[model samples]
Target: MTPLTLQTPEEHPFAQFVRILGKGKRGARALTREEAREAMGMLLDGRVEDTQLGAFLMLLRHKEESPEELAGFTEALRERLRAPALAVDIDWPSYAGKKRHLPWFLLAAKCLAASGLKVFMHGGGAHTAGRLYTEQLLGPLGIPLCRDWAQAEHALANGGLAFMPLGDWAPALQRMIDLRNTLGLRSPIHSLARILNPLGARLGLQSIFHPGYQAVHREASQLLGDTAIVIKGDGGEIEANPDSPCHLYGTAAGLNWDEEWPALAAQRHVKPATLEPEQLLEVWRGEAEDSYGEKAVLATLALALRGLGRAREAAFAEAAALWQGRDRAAL
Candidate 1:
């Protein structure tokens, strides 16, 4: 008979998940979907210790994340989101601020709104420098940034377009996103935030800087049972560069697909000038002649239109027409 040993009850419930990922190279392994969900659930519940939280995140960062992990984490996160009582046609996330160009995608979203498509856009910035954020541009451009779900509903009902900051919609995750500065590295939250889709919109448009993330986003969206378009948009914002082939990954009605849209321009233009919110307004008004900018806007809109179920030819034609026929005075 052996003396009974108390096997130090498994560390903290959350620590078990951390140890699963941080175990040595040969011993460590990616968390299963359920494990990932439980880990994120613990983090969101504020039960994870701070020290463990950092170590867990860094361990994940070191190994990167699998699509299964993203799906689990995202599923856990969406559980905490509070959506407005309204219909949204597109779930547009704008996390990466524009650094190389003005946010041409904003104009595209406005174009969609002008065409009666309700666009629910959400994002965060300030973790990076010298970039123009959608929240900052929307206000001065006269578009409203919603302070809460009720305000988002009002904006959608009356204006057809609404913007929500991450901090307002999901403060817990926003707190994690904000940690980018302190950690000196982006955690998996960066990728997870783009797919939040809080409103349960039918279509989600996501952008990632890294090309590999394209597949990760596609798989995660499929797991969430939502349709989404993931692109390596210009400067990691949702705006596409018409001068380069745009790689697209998405699922529609349960069918997953990938395609490459040919570039619209022969030559890539140099960065025009310091991006200005007023410039966005000017282009929208048709008072500015930016061939590159206009093509970028229309091309980006075409992707959105296509994602929303318009035929390829029809989407492209409709996108160009909408850009040309937009209500310039609305902004």
Candidate 2:
């Protein structure tokens, strides 16, 4: 005689996260900070199954991620980053490529770097079509694209600026971003990447094209004890549109606030029919004049200056001076 025993299969480690999000309308709820950290840890470590990954990402996209979720996810990412300590002044995340205008913010960052501020800028590859990404223009703009942290450190120490592709430091996130076409929609990773601040910079500059995410970023930065500025920037990038009033949502020193910046132009300027990357150089080299582009650069620079504790008027003044004093032959 033998005793019959039955074995039960264990649940997948990642299944719990998916179930939490897709538990039907009433049963579904957001993951708490600890749960979010664990789930994101699995995702970053490639421990999540493909099916689970797809479902989790889509669910977050559908429900939209909460500030707590974003903060938790950022905590997971920061823990996994393979970067050495660097004295970076600004953490500028450039995920959204420009559609309507050249990235005037690129010029702003370069101007700041030339003024001796260490800027760490990172962005994903061109996952979407018809958009000019920052990486694409780095060559023409004479900015160094660091392929590794050593190169990044070198660039920062030598030139005061470094633009690293997302894949270089955070390959898992880059893979998730690459799923845009497969998923047919953006996932929460797009939002999370903006606030990674892997270098632990004093100030972070973020931009979102979609409405309502500004508050998410502001609150998440507050939770992470990060100083950040979020804006509905031009073409979803962090370049302010000089032709329209811009709203800024930010968090610093345990406080959250908002401000409205009036349009620099009295009237709206028509967008260029085509985007020429060389125009960035032209504007920088003092070889050509673009009224719209120049103002956009100044406005974006002012936003960064403001984040660094300058008064509104003082920020704009400092931005103008930085732009004016930039080496014409630098680019």
**Top lDDT prediction, candidate number:** 2
Give each model a TM-score.
0.95, 0.97
lDDT of 1 by residue, 223-250 (tens): 8789999999998888889989998898
lDDT of 2 at 50: 91
lDDT tens digits by residue: candidate 2, 1-331: 8999999999998999999999999999999989999999999999988999999999999999999999999999999988899999999999999989899899999999999999999999898999999989888787899999999999999999999999999999999999999999998899899999999999999998899989988999999999999999998888999999999998899999889999999999888999998888888889999999999999999999999999899999999999999999877
How many clashing residue pairs appear in each of the predictions shown? 0, 0
lDDT of 1: 0.86
Look at candidate 1 and give me any clashing residue pairs. Answer: none
Worst 10 residues of 1 by lDDT: 77-86
Estimate every model's Cα lDDT from 0 to 1: 0.86, 0.93
